[model samples]
Target: MNIDDLVKGIAAGERRALARGITLVESSREDHRAQATALLAALPKEREALRIGLSGTPGVGKSTFIESFGMMLIAQGLRVAVLAIDPSSSRSGGSILGDKTRMDLLSREKDAFIRPSPSQTHLGGVARRTREAVALCEAAGFDVVLIETVGVGQSETVVAEMSDVFLLLLAPAGGDELQGVKRGIMEMADIIVVNKADGDLKPAASRTCADYAGALRLLRKRPQDPDGFPKAMMVSALQESGLSETWGEVQALTDWRRANGFWARARAAQARYWFEQTVKHTLLAQLEAPKAKAALSELSDLVAQGAIDPTKAAQDFVAQLER
Candidate 1:
């Protein structure tokens, strides 16, 4: 399809056209990439929407939280789009795409669109085409775009970069989970939500939430919204409780960044990182070529035989490849 037709159709909120446009961007074919760039450029400029990222452990009820939160956001007269990343299985290298089934109620909402696409070897539990998909969503006029991660791995930082607000959802089950979650990735949450706060789990969830709140006090706050409060909340995604509070926090954080001029700097940094990644990936593809692959094999043999150090061999390989 031509760029103009696809761009116009997507701008008019055509789901099929938007899906096809994302597919084109995801493709590795050389010609398809050229078209993808054209389509990306055709997207209109829009910066008024809120971009929120949600991530947590595998069983933290991410899909459910997203569904409940999405419903609430739409009820408040905002259009929402969810892009949930489903990673490929280690064995089959194909995603199960189970998020849609998990979000049955939100799935039926015409104003809310939930798309779960495979990671396909992309970094940060997201598809390579996700950035383009987000831009497309913005151009199509979604008031809010929520990008959900595959898990709580270090890959979470990748999603954080694209979002205006990064929220970490936690399931405060009890004793050990509190201390256990104090490690690397989960601590970087701009807003932490302790989910499943209803029913029999309420007491345990509350205690765990207190533990996290204490934990936050010890660590230096990353930065602050204009309100001067670190964004944190406890919510029950299944019961549809506490969602409004969560939205309030998200809005406060975004507004703070805008009023403080941090928003411009953040977007500029995001663009630089995006450019670096594009260059890095292109070079890696060439290094993995069959001819280069054979040379790398020879380098490994030479290094193993003690004929050359690993670093020297790598530099040699790079020097030879450029010729």
Candidate 2:
């Protein structure tokens, strides 16, 4: 692939070129990794887009909410990109990649770009290359980039590192359900949205939203937010109700952060974070090399046979690497 031509195309906001760019970043091949690195380095850094991370459990209607939200953004004359992470099977390493299909209307929009990627057993509820993909989208001139996680869990907080606004989507549930939700993920959320707030469920959704609002009040206020922030609201993605209000809140929070100098600081911190993560991941990848794999196999046998404890075996392996 001609990196120069690809860069030109991306600068011109070509969707096809942007898609190929994301594919290049997601590839695991050594050559692809080098090209992806160059592609990222060559892209303009001044171009910026609002990065929103959306997380929720399986039945919480994340896809529906994203579709409605993306359409709304498009109607407002903004080019929107959606990176939906689908859960991959640990054994088969396969994903359904059905987010695009679920968002049929948004997928057909000329101003909307939707990309579904496999989680590949990544614990963060996002693909390993998602950060790079977001960069690609920004370079392609997207006004907003929405990252949809695989599902909400304890480790899903990792998305907070990449997103400017982290939205936690929830469904109408009983009081006990509120207690069951993990506090760690709750603390990471910038906005807690109770979805499906229409029909007979509207009352239940209102009650759930109130419960979450109260819960947010109990948690210590984060310095990065303005007054009355990290709050809860209700939205009906199916009926397209309350979506504009949610978007308004998101913009309000983001604008506040940008004005308070939190935005640039947060982005700088995120860059440093990804740099350290890259070093760790590169070191781990070395273990897959032929010689390293052989040594690891031998050490595994020794540990399994009880000749060496796992910790000692791991230490010896590290020592060999040091040599």
Candidate 3:
């Protein structure tokens, strides 16, 4: 398809066009990259959506919560877009991509768009093109864009960097699990939610919420959150309870950041971060060219034979790239 058609279709909120645009951006081919660049350039500069990063442990019911939360947003007449990142098989590099099936109701909503992307072994618990997908969704006039990570620990920090608000989801009996999670991830959270807070889990969920609230109090306040430390709450996604309140908290955090000038600064910083990352990616790709590969092989053999030190060999390879 033509670049103009793709840009116009995305701006018009055409689902097919949006999907194609996402596929284009996710493509690794040079031509597709060039086309994606042009498409992004044509998009509106003003961003209007709330970019949220939601993450938790594998079984934390992230998909369920998102469906409930997204439906709530749609009920309020907001267009919600979910960029769900599915974990790729380590051996096959394939993903289940079943988030759409999991979010049956929300996926059927006219105002909600769900896109499941494979992690493709990209670190940071997200797909490589997730940020670009966010831009596309925003350009498509989505009022809220939710990025659901693979929920593996450590790499979640990358999501925190890319989002306006970072929400950490926990399940009942999470007190011990909290100790296992990295303190940095908890520190980055603007809001903490304990899901499955219904039925027999109600009491446990409440306790988990309290435990997280207390833990958050002990950590240094995130500078961006003017409302002080992270706030914790309990909710039942299955029952769809407390969803509105949770959304209200998200809006409150977004408003606070916008009012404090942190929002704009954060987005600007994210843009710069992506720019640096793209440069590194491009350079690394160049290093994988046939000639570079030949040089690398020779360098590896030399290092293995002890004719050249590893560090020196790396420098030599870089020098060859420069030449």
lDDT-wise, the better of 2 and 3 is 2
Q: What overall lDDT, based on C-alpha atoms, would model 3 receive against the true structure?
A: 0.88
**CA lDDT of 311 in candidate 2?**
100
What RMSD, rounded to one decimal, does every model reach? 2.3, 1.4, 1.5
**Which residues of candidate 3, in runs, are more than 4 Å off?**
176-181
Q: List the pairs of residues colliding in candidate 3.
A: none
The window of 10 residues in a row where model 2 has the poorest summed lDDT is 174-183
Using TM-score, rank the candidates from best to worst. Answer: 2, 3, 1
Q: Model 3, clash count? A: 0
Clashing pairs in 2: none
Clashes of 1: 0
Q: How well does candidate 2 match the true structure in TM-score terms?
A: 0.97
Candidate 3 accuracy as TM-score = 0.96
lDDT of 1 at 60: 85
Error of 3 at 242 (Å): 1.2
| TM-score of every candidate | 0.91, 0.97, 0.96
